[model samples]
Target chain A: MKTIGLYKYLPIEHKESLLDLETDRPIPTRKDLLVEVKAISINPVDVKVRSPKENVEPSPKILGWDASGTVVEVGEDCKLFKLGDEVFYSGSITRQGTYSEYHLVDERIVGHKPKRITHAEAAALPLTTITAWEALFERLRINSDDVEGNKEKTILIIGGAGGVGSIAIQLAKWAGLNVVATASREESVAWVRKLGADEVINHYQSFTEQLTNLQIQEVDYILCLNHTEQHWESMGDVIRPQGKICSIVETEEPLNLNVLKNKSVTFVWEFMFTRSMYQTEDMIEQHLLLNNVSGLIDKGVLRSTMNQKLSPINASNLKKAHALVETGRTIGKVVLESF
Target chain B: MKTIGLYKYLPIEHKESLLDLETDRPIPTRKDLLVEVKAISINPVDVKVRSPKENVEPSPKILGWDASGTVVEVGEDCKLFKLGDEVFYSGSITRQGTYSEYHLVDERIVGHKPKRITHAEAAALPLTTITAWEALFERLRINSDDVEGNKEKTILIIGGAGGVGSIAIQLAKWAGLNVVATASREESVAWVRKLGADEVINHYQSFTEQLTNLQIQEVDYILCLNHTEQHWESMGDVIRPQGKICSIVETEEPLNLNVLKNKSVTFVWEFMFTRSMYQTEDMIEQHLLLNNVSGLIDKGVLRSTMNQKLSPINASNLKKAHALVETGRTIGKVVLESF
Candidate 1:
């Protein structure tokens, strides 16, 4: 099986950062599905995990998470999926990732791929979609079923053109919220607007001022996909009293949590890997949500977020995708198809 | 009308820290209810707000909040209460407080007094009950209506013997959650146990070790009533993945919020004053929940947490109650009754 593996974490510019290797195809065990990788997407988590580090792996370390693949085999305990099922998943951080021709994932965290989209497009959806879904519905506790109740509610999606933000804008809109998205660049702004953002505000400007200009006093919720530290105070300023803020970005320093105290705001971290990493009792929620998202996609309520696609999944193509994502300005998602 | 007013922020020992002032009775308007104060309770907020500082008020500044009284007058717009109606409430922080012979409050935040308890007992409830109920069912999103669903959930309440924790323990228990409360003193431990805490742990010790010893690996929710900065990390350590943590205590410094990121944990502030302070659309929720609490108390499902009571609400009695609460060791609530 052809795989993209690394011996040591290095900058993307380095030739040795990612290498093509022939690794033995892994087998399925206890609720695991042996997925033959079809397409993969690059996310910030992939870059962060593969960032330059001093530690070296004794063996090849596979380094991808988002994948759209076919389940070639299933373990004895697997009930959600079967052999030949086309699946999509953001594989667990603790397990061997999906930067290989074949990967193993727990069936509880995998979803059947949206039949309406191509594999490359499907690959772009899993990681970001799962994150946006959980951050909106689970972490922030938005009642997605109550469209009438959500009509009066508004959500601000920070970094709206990024992978997660792109999907979050759509999901928030789908949930019947007044969606205000932040995008600084012209292309990014247009992209988010196209993705169903009712209002677009620049992330570089004062969120309060921008929202006020748009006749929004404060947002009912905020989904932060950019630097949590940089937007911490701005988010605090614009969130309504008793509102919720969910962030996927990891901050470099401690946060001044006191800023939100008077408003009694809720601050939640929405790491998509949390369920798989902890093996929580509700880990299967990811599977369920993903299936729901797939159904939404099939119904034409959501479009694939894949903005750029590279063919023949290889180290070079992944490195190229990594470098593009590293610029931190890529709109939507960058995917690689057909290893 | 006789009121306990302060001209300067001073230590509790100061002679003029609180003074009895003869003031004209206030009239009700715009959903306002003019209540003849019968009883009042001293909470940590009162002590904190009255803490020593250089600021001086040109006029006497009143400082108490929790009150049980009779509505002497009601504004034309006030439909929630009428003249002679007995009520209990924690008035908005933005308004002059409740340490007067006659106090004015918005009828939307006032609740019918529990028929089973005396004015002194009811006075001990409003501030703490509102804080606990909001922290549990609202901020933590625990469904008190879903007792069967809550049976599998567990909550660890820090500082179980304090004003808010006492009520939180009972409310969490009523919600059918397994409640673990923290107390260091033997008397405090016994008090929380009597309040229906399923288990009692010492906050001075490690929560992880204590819960593990009790065969509990982690809790689904944490209600923090003590110092948030001190328990932030420990609260993160024992919280189950995707768990919610609600804190009433303020932090002295920035918090390392990253500690909870891996678990996708929720950190929410449960400021009892948020709704009323912000004049939010849901400000009336306090009135609704307080009425629910009153019914619960009348039904014997909940009880007043008043422990010690002082007679003839005067400056001297208030000073003593403030001094006792400032000690940070007062179990239950210190209340003063009858002006």
Candidate 2:
């Protein structure tokens, strides 16, 4: 099997940052599905994991998360998936990832790919969609079934042009929330609005002022996709009493949680890999959510976030994708297809 | 009306710390209830409000939260209680407080006094009970009806001998969760166990070790009634993946929130006054919960936490209660009856 891996942490521009390597195909075990990778997408996690760090690895480490694949083989104990079944998932962070010709994933976390979507489009949807879905519905505890209750509520999505935000806007709107998204550039602003943001504001400016100009007092929820520390105080100020705020971005500095004391607000972090990393009992929820997302996409209620695609899964294309994500300005997802 | 108030934040031992003063009786308006306070309880909030600060007030500020009284007057819109109805409540933080002979409170936050309990006992309950109830059921999202489900789960209550902890132990037990309470002193341990904690451990030691010794791996919920910053890392270690945590204690320093990332654990602050402070639509929920709590107490499902009582609510007894609370080691709650 051909795989893309890194032996050492280095900048994406470096020659050895990610390289093509030959590896033996792994056999399926209990609840495992041997998947033949068809398409893979690059995300911020890939960049963070491959960034410069001490302690070199003994073996080449695989570093992709989003993939649309086919089950080549299924373990005897697997109850959800069968051989030749098309699937899509953001593989577990603690194990080998999906940037390879073949990969193994637990059947519980894998979902059937949308029948109407292409492999590249399906691949781009899994990681970001799962993240946005779990962040809004699970972590934030938004009542997805209560459209009437949600109509009066509002959600602020930071970094609206990013992959997760593209889907988050649609999901929040689907749940009947007023969506306020932040975008710094003209194209990004238009992109987020097109994706169903009720209002789009510049992230570089004061969020409070933008909200005030729009005649909105405070948001009921905030999903921060970028620079949590930079927007911490502003989020604290603009969140309603008893409101919830969730962020996927990790902070470099400690957060002053006291700002939310008077309001009794809730702060939660959504790391998409938490269930898989901890082998939680509810890991199957990802499978359920992904399948639902697939159904919604097929039903035209949601759309894939795939914006750029490259030919053939290889080290050079993977490096290009990583470089584009490293710029921190790419809108939607960049994927590679066909090994 | 006679009142006990402080013109400046001073040491509890100071003669002028909590002064005896005469103030005009306030009239009830809107949803206000002019209650003649019969009994008042001292909570940590009283100590916090009376703590030394740099600023001096133009007028003496009253500083009590928990009170049991008879409604002497009802506002035009107040339909919950009539004149001479005995009620207990943890009044709003923004109000004039219960240290006075006559105090005004919102009808929504008040509950009918338990017929089975004395005024002092009822006074000891409202503040702590409200905090614990909101922290467990609302913030932690514990299902009150899922007794069988809760039987398999565990909740670790930090500071189990404190006012909120005393009520939290009883409420957690009522919910059918195995309650692991942290208490240092022998008497405090006995007190928590008597309050229905399934097990007792010292908060000063490693909580993980205590749980491991008891053959427990992690807790499903954590209600932190004490210092959040001190026990944060320990709470992170013991919280199960996808578990929920709620706290009433304010952190003095910035918290390292990344500790809960791997488990996707939720941390929420439960300030009982939040709904009333914001005049939230769900403010009626407080009235409902308190009425339910009153029923539980009358049915002998929950017990009052008043361990000490003083007669005739005045400057001297309030000063004594303040001094005891300032020690930071008071068990249960202390109440003062009548004026």
Candidate 3:
């Protein structure tokens, strides 16, 4: 099998930052599906993993998470997926990734791909969709059933033009929340509004001031996809008393949690890999959420966030995708398809 | 009217720390009840309010929260209680407190005092019970409807012998969680066990090791009634992935929130005053919870934690109670009764 991987962490522009390597195809085990990777999407995690680090790998570290593929073989214990099934998944973070020609994923976290979407488009949806879904519905505890109850609620999504934020804006709108999204550039601002943001604010400015100018007092929820530390105090200032806030961005500094004490606000971190990392009993929830997202996408209630695509899954194209994501300004998702 | 209050923050031993003062009787307004206080309880909040500081108040600041009293007058808009009805409440933190002979409280946060309990016992309950109930059921999102489901879950109550922790142990037991409480002293351990903690561990030791010794791995919920910063790392370690943690104690320093990222754990602050402070639409939930707590006490499902009492609420007795709580080692609660 041919794969794209890193033997040592280096600048993406450096020669051999990513390499074309030959590896033996892995066999399916209990609850595993041997998937033939058809399309792969690049995320900021890929850039972070590929950045310069002190340790060199003994074996090449394949790094990719989002994929749309076909199941080539299924383990005997697998109950959900069958051979030749078209599937999409944001594979586990601790295991080998989807950059290989063939990959293995637990059947419980894989979902049937949206029938109406192309492989590239489907590949772009899984990771961001899972992140957005879990951050809003699970971590923030947004009530999806009560549309009337949600109509009065508001959510502020920082970095709203990014992959997860694009989907998050839509999901929050679907849950009937008034969506206030932050995007610095005009294009990004227009992008979030197109994705259903009720209002757009500048992330570089004071969030409270922007909200005040919009005649909004405070937000009921805040989903921070950008810098957590930089926005922490502003989030504390703007979140309603007893309101909830969730962030996916990791902070470099410790947070003064006492800022939220007087308001009795909640702060939750939503790392989408938590279930898979811990092998939690509810790991199957990922499969369920992906299926729900697929249904919504097929039903035209949601759309894929595939903003850019490259041909032929190879080291060069993967490196290009990584470089684009490293810029930290990619609007949605950048995908690669076909070997 | 006679009241005990402080014009300046001072050492607890100072004779004028809490002063006896005479003031005009306050009249009831819309939704207000002019209650003749029969008993008032000292909580940690009283100590915090009286702790030495440089600022001096223009007028003396009354500092008591838990009170049991008879409504002497009801405003036209007050529908929950009539004149002469005995009620107990942990009133709003923003309002003038319950240290005065006549106290004015909003009717909505008040509940009918348990008929079976004495006024001192009822006073001991309101502040601690409201804190415990909201921390467990609201902040932690414990499902009270499914006792069978709850029986499979576990909760760790830190500082199990404190006022809030005592009531929390009982409430968690009522909600069917396997309750593991942390208490250092033998008497405090016995107290929590008597309040229905299934097991007791010392908060000074490693919580994970203690839980492991007891054949438990991790808890589904954690109610932190003591220092959050001190136990934060251990709490993160012993919390199940996707578990909930609620705390009434505010952290004095910044917290390393990134530790809970991989587990996607929730951290919520439970200030019982949140609803009243914000004048939230759901403020009546306090009334409902207190009424439910009253029923539980009357039915003998929950016991009052009034461990000490002093007659005729006065400056001296109130100061004494405040001094005890300032030591940060008081067990259960201390109540000062009728003037």
Provide the TM-score for each candidate, comma-separated. Answer: 0.99, 0.99, 0.99
So what's the TM-score on candidate 2? 0.99
Question: Candidate 1: where are CA atoms >4 Å away?
Answer: none
Listing candidates in order, what is each one's chain A TM-score? 0.99, 0.99, 0.99
Ranking by DockQ: 1, 3, 2
Interface RMSD of each: 0.6, 0.9, 0.7
Per-residue C-alpha lDDT of model 3 across residues B1-339, encoded as one tens digit per residue = 999888989998888798999988899999999999999999998888778999999988988998999999988899999988999998988989999999999999999999999999999999899889989888898987778899999999999999999999999889889999999998998889888999999999999899999999999999998889999999999999999999999788998999889999999999998899999888899999999999999999999999889888999988778878888989999999988
Error of 2 at B112 (Å): 0.6
Kindly list the per-residue Cα lDDT of model 1 for residues B1-339, writing each as its tens digit: 998999999999999999989988988889999999999999998999999999999988999889999999888899888788999999988888889999999988999999999999999999999999999988998999899999999999999999998898999999999999999999999999999999999998999999999999999999999989999889989999999999988889998999999999999999988988889988899899999999999999999999999999999999999999999999999999998
Report the lDDT tens digits of candidate 2 across residue range B88-189.
Answer: 999899888899999999999999999999999999999899999999998899998999999999999999999999999999899999999999999999
**TM-score of chain B taken alone, candidate 2:** 0.99
Which segments of model 3 are wrong by more than 4 Å? none
Instruction: Give one digit per residue, the lDDT tens place, for model 1 in A16-97.
Output: 9999999999888899999999999999888988999999999999988899999999998999987799999998999888
Q: iRMSD (Å) of candidate 2?
A: 0.9
What shift in Å separates residue A183 of candidate 1 from its native position after superposition? Answer: 0.8
Q: Model 1 residue B182 lDDT? A: 96
Per-residue alpha-carbon lDDT of candidate 3 for residues A1-339, written as tens digits (9 for 90 to 100): 999988889999998899999999999999999999999999888887778987899998999999999999988899998888999999999999999999999999999999999999999988899999999999999988889999999999999999999899999999899999999998998899899999999999999898999999999999999899999999999999989999998899999998898888999999889989999999999999999989999999899899999989999999899989998999989999997
| Model 3 residue-pair collision total | 0
| Comparing 1 and 3 on lDDT, the stronger one | 1
